[model samples]
Target: RLRAGVVMLIDLLSSVPSVVFGLWGILVVAPAITGVYTNISSALSGVPVLRTVFSGAPISGRSFFTAGLILAIMITPIITSITRETFATVPRAQKDAAYALGATNWEMIRGSVLPFSRSGIVAGVLLGFGRAIGETIAVALVIGSSPQITQRLFSSGDALSAVIANQFGESTGTYQAALIGMGVLLFVITLVISAFARAMIARAERRIGAESV
Candidate 1:
């Protein structure tokens, strides 16, 4: 419930310009962290700090966390809207039935209601995942734009969408083909995940129907 409400708020917030968020991340949040990191180093050193504060601020252009976070910002609104719609679709009669059976709100949501709407929720989530995977400009602006992969949230890395966004214009024939190939790979992955989610949803629906009958 907490997460849903937060996602709802973020979704509402995200309807604003993504560039605004990107720029805000760049100008404000980045500086604060850079200052903190630099200050920690300066404090540890006994000698007076020669390097200017944040003069060599980390580029912070790309990292897995940065890309994921930017994409999350872009997709929050979409996911929240989809979730709201899915929840709305739950039949009033079914909810009332659960209530009559002495089910609490959480119980009703956990049992009768969720099972019926599970497929739609899964569908919505898969769509949101796809949207996150495809976001470009917002991610490009903040992602350190690095090609190498690293596990650290602070390290820079690029996603397929970010790479395409960064290099497509300058790309020549073979480079463009390579970019297209990356797109194809992403498309394939998305398609597979969607198909799997749909299949699982279908199986769950069938199981629920059987159990109910």
Candidate 2:
């Protein structure tokens, strides 16, 4: 019953509209995290390589960090569902054999379950990344919608999807074409990432098969 309830909750979260999450991120999350963002920005402003990344002084929470956090939250349910299903598919016989070999619970999971599920986990993570890349409204709200590039993580910057979504309506002529071009670029990038993910999954499977043999 508890497991069923948990599954139901994840399903509900995954099914909730992306726009709703965007509103929540902007209204609640952005305000709440502003102080933390400011502090981090201040602390890391003088570090070596990181100083560049955290160079900007952030007055508010809307930034790459905030957008990324929201994206992670949005994708968590999907990833969790996939991971749960993947773990459930691990063979009972394999687990029993590991236990029979005097493997502790942690050791059994590390050696048997993890190896068996590694490919599935990789696929799940990549799927989450794909979802995140395509996400628009939510990311745009939290990402500050600035087009300029900077080393600062706390600075407002535009993602390809966010820029297209925000400007595509008012844009005309070459500007409109450029936004459409960005859409094409986004599609090609996603396609490449998906192909890369498939390759990675295949490589993991081959390595796992070799280890099992």
Candidate 3:
């Protein structure tokens, strides 16, 4: 019953409009976290490698860091729901066998349940990452829309999707073609990542098969 309830709730949350998430991130989440981002950037200023990545104005939290954080939050429910279903599908006998061998609850989960669900979890995470990549409204609102490359994570920045969504209406000729090209690039990248994920899943399945043998 609890599991069913969780599934329903997650479904409802995932169905909410993207623009709503954008409004919330910009109006509520961004204002709340601006100071935190600033302080973190300042605190990391002296660190070697991290200093370069973390040093920035933060500019009231409309930044790469904020956009990424918001997107992660938005897609989390989808990933969690998929992962929960994957975990729930594990065989009862496998868990019992682990316990019968005197395994702790955590150990049983690690040795039995996770191995079975590993591929499913990876697929779920990939789905979430893909969703994040295509997200536009929320990202556009919180990403500050700056078009530049920088090591500073807190710097204002925009993603390919955000750029396309924000500019496609006014773009013309070469500008429009460039935006379309970005979409193509994103699609190719996603395909490559998916293929790599498939390979990883296949390798893991083979390893598990060998262990069982």
Top candidate (lDDT): 2
lDDT of 1 at 147: 80
Per-candidate TM-score against the hidden true structure: 0.68, 0.87, 0.86
Q: Give the Cα error of residue 113 in candidate 2, in Å.
A: 0.7
TM match of model 2 to true structure: 0.87
Using lDDT as the yardstick, the better of models 1 and 2 is: 2
lDDT of 1 by residue, 151-178 (tens): 4455556678879878988999999999
The CA lDDT at 99 in model 3 is 96
Clash pairs, candidate 1, are 61-143, 61-144, 62-143, 62-144, 62-156, 62-157
- Give lDDT: candidate 1, residue 30: 58
lDDT (CA) for every model shown?
0.68, 0.84, 0.83
CA shift at 44, candidate 1, in angstroms? 20
Question: What TM-score number comes out for model 3?
Answer: 0.86
**Regions of candidate 3 where Cα sits further than 4 Å from its true position:** 1-9, 191-213
1 versus 3: better lDDT goes to: 3
The model with the greater lDDT, 2 or 3, is: 2
Error of 2 at 133 (Å): 0.5
Q: Where is the poorest 10-residue window by lDDT in model 3?
A: 200-209
